[model samples]
Every structure is written in C-alpha cells, then in structure tokens.
Target: MRIIEDPRSYALVMVILASFLTPFVASSINVALPSLGSELGMGPFMLSWVPTVYLLAVAVLLIPMGRLADIYGRKKIFQFGIILFTVSSVFAGFSISPEMLLFFRVIQGIGGAMIFSNVSAIIFSVFPPVDRGYALGWSATGTYFGLFFGPTLGGFLTQYFGWRSIFYFNVPLGVLCAYATGRIGFEWREAEGEKFDLRGVFLMAISLVFVLVGFSSILSIYGFSLFVVGMFLLYFFYRYECGCDSPLFDFDLFKNRTFTWNGFTTFISYFAGYPVVFLLSLYLQYFHGLDPWMTGIILSIQAFLIALASPVAGKFSDNKSPRIIAAVGLFIIILAMVIFSFSGFLYWIILGLVFMGVGFAFFSIPNSKLVMGAVEKRFLGVASATLVTFRVLGQLIGMALIVLLVDVYLVGGSVAVGPFRALMTVSFILFILLLLVGLVLTLKAR
Candidate 1:
C-alpha cells in the first residue's frame, strides 16, 4: 500500500484509530463482563475490578505519559503504546485466572493512556484553528463508532466463541493501528529538553490510586481512611507542582478560563454518561432476560446516534459559540437521564438512549474543540493530557459509584425490580445535579 503522506490525513487516521481502540476495548469488555466473570469464577465485587483496574491504570498514568510524550516524542510513544496494547490483549485472552486478566488489563490501561494523551496534541500540531474542529469532530465520530460497535460486536464474539474472543477481536485492529503509526512521518515533541518531574509523577500516582481505590471501596472505614490520605497527598501534589520549575502538570494552565471551564463541564458529562452502557447491559441481561446479542443491539442505538451526531456538532461549533453548543448538549443529557429514571418500557429506554447519544456528541466534540482551541502551542500536551485525565477521572468516579450502588441495591448482583428502578432514579437525580452545575459553568466561562 502507498504511504499516505499528507499531514492532515496522517493526524486524522491516527486520532481515529487511537480513539477507536481505547473505547472499543473498554465497552467490548463491558459487554463480555458476565461471561468473562463466570469463566473466571469472579463474584460481583471481584468482577467489578476487571474494568476498574483498567481505568485506574489509565487515570494514574495519562498525564505522566503525556509529559513523557512532550519530552520524548508523540509518535514514538504512540507507536509503543499500540504495540503494548496489542500484545496485552493477546495475553488477556489467554489468561486462565481473574488475577491474570486484571494484570493484563492494567497493562492495557497503560497503553490506553499513551495512545490518548497524544491524540489531541497531534491533531492540533497538524490542523490549523479553522479546521481543528472538523478534525476533532471526525475523531469524535471514530470514538462514537467504537462505542457503537463495541457492545454489539463484543456480544457476537462472546456468544459464539466465548468471552475470550472479545479480547482476541482487537488483535488485527491493533496491528493496523501500529502499522499506521509507523507511516506517519512527522513527530511532535514541543516540550523537548524540559526536565521531567519524576517525584511529582510518583506523588500524583499515589494520591490518585489511594483516593480512587478508597472511593470504590465505598463507605467502608478502611476505604474512608484511604480517601483521607489520598486527599492529603493530592493537596501535597498541588503544592509541589506549584513550586517546581518543570512540573509534570502546570498549575498556571488553569488560568485559561476556556480551558478550565470546558474541562470541568466535560468531566461532568462523562461522569454521568459513561456508566449507561454498563448498567443497561446488566439491566437487560439479568432483569429483562435478553441475551447479550439483544442487549448489545439495544445499546447500539445510543452509540450509533453519537457517531451520526459528533461530526455535525463539531462543524456547528466552528460556526457558533462552543459554550452555547455544550450547554445545550448537557441540557439534553439531563432530559435523557430523566427518561431513564422512569423507564419501564423498551420505548422509554430507547428514547433515553437516543437523547444521550445526541447529547454526548454535541457536548464532547465542541467541549474538546473549545479546550484545545483555548491552549497555547507550548501547552498542547498538557492541555491534551488534562482534558483526557478529567474525562477518565469522571469515568472512574462513575464506575466507583456504580459499585457502591450495586452493593446496596443489587443483592449480590441479583435483580430486584424496585431497587433497580430506585438506582436509576437516584442516578438520574444525581446526573441532573451534576450536569446542571456543568451547564452553569459552561455559560459562565468566557
């Protein structure tokens, strides 16, 4: 095959593949969770760790990996990430124990961090401001496609070949991404020669791990203690970064109002939105008695709509104020969740998914465009890492919250109609509060 030499196409392909792989792996695993857990003999608590561990690894490592990309090279780091992720997927499929699967998942998360931290940075490096939203929109479509297909395809694989096939499915796609990475000619390292703050990375990692682990532990005394320690360490991380000459994360970047507020709102959107697939999968399979394939088909409605809407949202933001676009999107999300809270019929559930699909597309593409468009060239990697970090952190929180709710209402992951409906209702209220804050902040930002 002839090498594609144009820089814009290079960036677009890279972002799409990178964006596709991370979410594909995540949602695919979600659809396979029941089958995978059964084979591994994992209970509800241990099973939750499968996805939690992956997100945690990504959350802790994203900013550090982004800093490394800035210091070393984005293409180099990105290529290595794809290779590592592909290899790990193979190992994860072969794993005979839950422990082994979780370990490989952690490795996969590390690779996920490396792939995503540079995606936006590379796009900005190649695309000019006027065209950046277009690139981001297309990239968002790739992400939504991953979301769109992950469940349906994963269900197909799991049903026929067993859950292990879900992991194996990525082998070819990962190889394709790796091959594409090699062909991209230009390298981005805008922060070369900047000293990497090793201690800061360590401190941040400790703080984040403790806090997340504790929070996921959920209302336990030991968990609360861990949370306290994590909070202190996080505060210490803030103080340390403030004084460092070459901090891994710069405190000053928050001074950019557009960057700051967009980050906050994006975080809120993902927090409330990320768990819908996971929760609904369980609801349909366990409660409604639908098979994985049928559940996947139902779930695809939301992701498919996102794929349809993201590019349009991106293009529209180029013409309108991104703030208004994002706010409208969040408002739609609130509406979707409200429908979910009351959903007993399939129609209501589908309606809710449709609303969420459009909402997330409109919110995410423009929100990302705003944040990336707001930063300076020197801070590209920082901004990219920060945007992703916030999004992942919110996802982590959502998952943790789900675990808590599951323990309280799920009765060993068994379905009780009243409790299940209550869970949805509670989540709906929480989402409204969260998205409302994000909406106010979005409009408030300059």
Candidate 2:
C-alpha cells in the first residue's frame, strides 16, 4: 500500500497517531487508579491530581505553544513535542513514588499540548478546503477511537500486568509515530518578523492553571476561595490579552458566530459529557465490584458506539447544517442522561452508555468541522489551539463539578448511586443548554 503517495496525507496520519496517544494515556490511567492508590498509598485527593495535573498543564500550555508554533514552525515544535512526550512516558513508567509520577505526567502534558495544538492546523494546511472536512472527520475519529480504547486497554494491561504498564504501553507506539513524523514533510511558513507575546502567554498560563487547580480542589478544601482566585486571575488574563501587541488568544475569532457558538457548545457538551465515562467506570468498579477486565468490556460498549457513529455524523455535517446535526446528537445525549438518572439496573446502564456514545459521535465530529470551518488557514494553529483549550477547560470544570456534586449529595463517605443519578440530571441540563447554543449559532451562521 502506497499510503505515502501524498506525503502530506502520510504526515497527517502520523500526527493523528501521535495525537491519539495522549488521550490514551489520559483515560487509560483511570481504571488503574484503584490499583495505583493501593500500591503508592495515595489518598483520594492525590489520586485525583494524577489526572488533574496533566489536564491542567495541557490546557494552560496549548495556546501559548500554538502561538509559538505559528511564530517558529509547526513541524519544529511538533517534533519537539514527540521527543518530550516519549521521554516523559519513560519517566512515568519508572516512577518510584506518586510525586515522581505526577512530575512526569506534567511533562507529558507539555508534549500533549504541542501535539494537539498543531494537529488540526496541520490537517487544514495539508488538505484542500473541499476535502478538509472529510480529512478532519477521519482525524477526529482517530482521537475518539483512542478515547474509546484507552480505558479498556489500560484496564486490561493494569489487571494482567501492573498499573505502570499503562505508561509503558505508549513506548513503542510513540517511537513509531515519532519516526513517521520525522520523514513526513510540511511547507513551513515562517512569521517573518512576528514577535512572541511573552507577557500574554504568562498571564494566560497562570490564569488557566489557577482556574483549573481551584476547580480540581473544589472537592477538597477552600473550594470557594479557589474559585474566587481563579475568577480574579482570569479577569486579569483577559485584560492582559486585550493589551498585548500580539495576543495569545485573538478575541476577534469569537466575532464569528460559528466559532463562538461551536466553541461554547463544545465546551458545555463535553463538560457534562466526559464525566459520565469517568464516573460510570468508577461506579462499575468501586460500587458494583466489577473486576478491571469486566469494567473494560462495559466501557468498550460506549466506545464502540462512538466509533461506529462518528464518521457517519462527520460525513453528514459536511453536506448539511452541523448545527442541526449537533442538536440531534445532544438530544440523544439528553435521552441517555435521562435514562441514566432513573436506572440502577446493569442492562439499562449499558443501553444508556450506547446512547451516550452515539450522541458523542454526533456532537464531536460535526462540532469540530464547524469550528475549523469558521477560521481561516492563517489562523488555524491558534484556532485549533483555542478550541482544544476550551475543551480542556470544560473537562476540568466538568470533572470538578462532578466531584463536588458527588461530595455534596453523597449520603455516606462512599458515594451512592443516587448522587450519580443526580449527576446525570445535571448533565442532561447542560446538554439542553448546549442544544440551545447550537441552534442560536446555526441560525446566526446562516
């Protein structure tokens, strides 16, 4: 198979593969948390940071790194990301303690930021506008597919081998991806005399970190204080961006209704949507006492549905109004959430998972197409980076809300299935809001 006939296509595939690995590492560790906690004597607070720290790093760094890629060269920064991610993975696999593991995970986030910030930009640049939607759809599918397999694969490896194997699993895949990216070529356009906005970068990074950290700690102590500080820092960060000669985020992008609404809708939808995966896994393992392998099977059902539906949804979005498609998808998600709120039965839970997956597929692929379509080629790096930053922020806020809600509504020290039901209620409400956002944006887009 001469897959390399179009060098750019080959390069896109490598980027997709590299990008896929990060999410795999992100979700794969969830199933292993119990085992990791036991081995490392980690408390629930510290265990939570294992994922929080990584996500926080990625969210904060994404925009700054994307701007840097635009200034320097996308290929240069992307290659560096691969090296950093690979090295960090090795460090994670060999960590002697939780602190050491977290340190490496933070480094892993830096690498992930580099890969994710540049990927959609690279795809847009390589493929012509007409074909870009389908190409991006394929790329988006690769990412969701990674999300699908990550937990299940992590659970399988962790159960049969050890939790450390989750980190180690990326070693070979990373090496191959790095090699593929090296041989792949891109036409680099230098920002002739574009100066970097160091101040804007610093403020944004600090602002996002404070916000995410505060939210992550909401389930713990000083939740109100953290929230206050986070809001204050973000206010300053927005002011800082406004004054910068070269801003990290171009507020002008938000002027486009498609960009604005898609970003907002993506944030809300994913914010409420992703926690279901995390919470459900925990429910099955901790509450129902399912083994790691069995939990993997249950999670796989959701992943499989997503895998099946995403490409179809993406194809439809290319021809029709993504706004309508996305709303329909959210409707499915709402249905799934409603069902989840009422059910404690295992079979019903599985059916709900399937619906949730279908909704995600519908929502994600088209939403991505809409965002990318809204931006010009010149701004693709920043646009893609901004999109990812919002998504990560949404995830951070979503997870924190879930944890906080679980703490408040939980009757005993252990979380009951009832709180999980309440969480579903909240998720459904968020989905309805997303549908409204999508509808307004679609109307405006027309």
User: Tell me, what's the RMSD of every candidate?
Assistant: 2.7, 2.8
Off by over 4 Å in 2: 34-44, 190-192, 218-221, 282-292, 342-345, 414-423
134-198: candidate 2 lDDT, tens digit per residue = 66666766776787788777878999999999988888888877887777656554453577888
Identify the candidate with maximal TM-score: 1
Q: How many clashes (backbone N, Cα, C below 3 Å) per candidate?
A: 0, 0
How well does each candidate superpose onto the true structure, as a TM-score? 0.91, 0.89
Least accurate stretch of 10 residues (summed lDDT) in model 1? 1-10
> How high is the lDDT of residue 218 in model 1?
50
- What tens digits encode model 1's per-residue C-alpha lDDT throughout 260-283? 988998888888898887878777
Q: Output the lDDT of residue 8, model 2.
A: 70
What are the lDDT scores of the predictions, listed in order?
0.86, 0.78
Clashes of 2: 0
